[model samples]
Target: MNVLVLYATVEGQTRKIAEHVAARIEGQGHMVVLGDVRDPGFAVPGTFEAIVLCAPIHMGRYPEAFVRFVTDWKTAIEAVPNALVSISLAIHSDNAEERAEAEAYPIHLQHKSGYHPASVHHAAGALKFLEYDFFKRFLMRRIAGKEGGPVDTSRDYEFTDWAALDQFIDAFAGQIAQP
Candidate 1:
């Protein structure tokens, strides 16, 4: 299987996830390309046998650029075995409603872009407190405090579950590798 791992990131965690996904696909003996969708030269979706699109949720929605990319390439993207990696802090919330909100984000994206992915994986993102500006840091701190999440602005905190992500990649690779 030839795989394309496409991603757009606000806090950079999605890029890391996409890299891992691409590496995992390659480890499975498939050809893989990792593309930052923000790049002007990012490859089109049709060229790949499988695709994993990773996007982060900022203020409850994905970046507009990523949304537009998928909308524009919906036909080509849908033609392949596509999976979506939705990255957000809400997915790690102990609150059930918050988790549901995180899970429902992909549905919103699909409805708006008319691109129905073959699979979806919800990934917990990090609080890049050190990378955020003053306003962003303050806002994230408040959100985190409210959710009983990490509030230390001095350093970053990651909430991604690597084992689960690996399992998802293995399953995806197995499915795509089927003759």
Candidate 2:
């Protein structure tokens, strides 16, 4: 399959996940074009089989720029099998409300982005204190504390489950290969 993995990131965790996704697809003998949605330079070739959109959660939302980009090219995206992966710390929260917060973007994309993706993957994001500013680091730690999550800001917390991600990708790959 010809696949495009477009993503947006603030602290680079989303980018890492995108790379992992692309690598998994490539390992299955698929051609993958991984690009940032912020400045997607390549034209969407009409022959592509699938496209995967990924973005990190910031302030409880996916980047507006990415939303705009996808909206503007909805026709091209709709022409292929597609999936969306939303990365957020909220995804790790066992609380129903926190999980709802994590699903907000994917819900919006499904109903508003005008593209019906074949699948949706919600993955927990990382907390990279080393990449955050003092205020952000403090805020995140406090929020984590409230949620009974990791409070140590001296290091990082990665909630992503690689095995689960692989399983999701493999399932999507199967969908793309269907006649």
CA RMSD of all predictions: 1.2, 1.9
- Residue 157, model 2: Cα distance from true site in angstroms: 0.8
Q: For residues 104-147, could you state the per-residue lDDT of candidate 1 as single tens digits?
A: 99999989999888899999999999999999999999999999
TM-score of 1: 0.97
TM-score of each: 0.97, 0.92
**In order, what lDDT does every prediction score?**
0.90, 0.84
**List of clashing residue pairs for candidate 2:** none
lDDT of 2: 0.84
Tell me which residue pairs clash in candidate 1.
none
Clash count list over all predictions: 0, 0
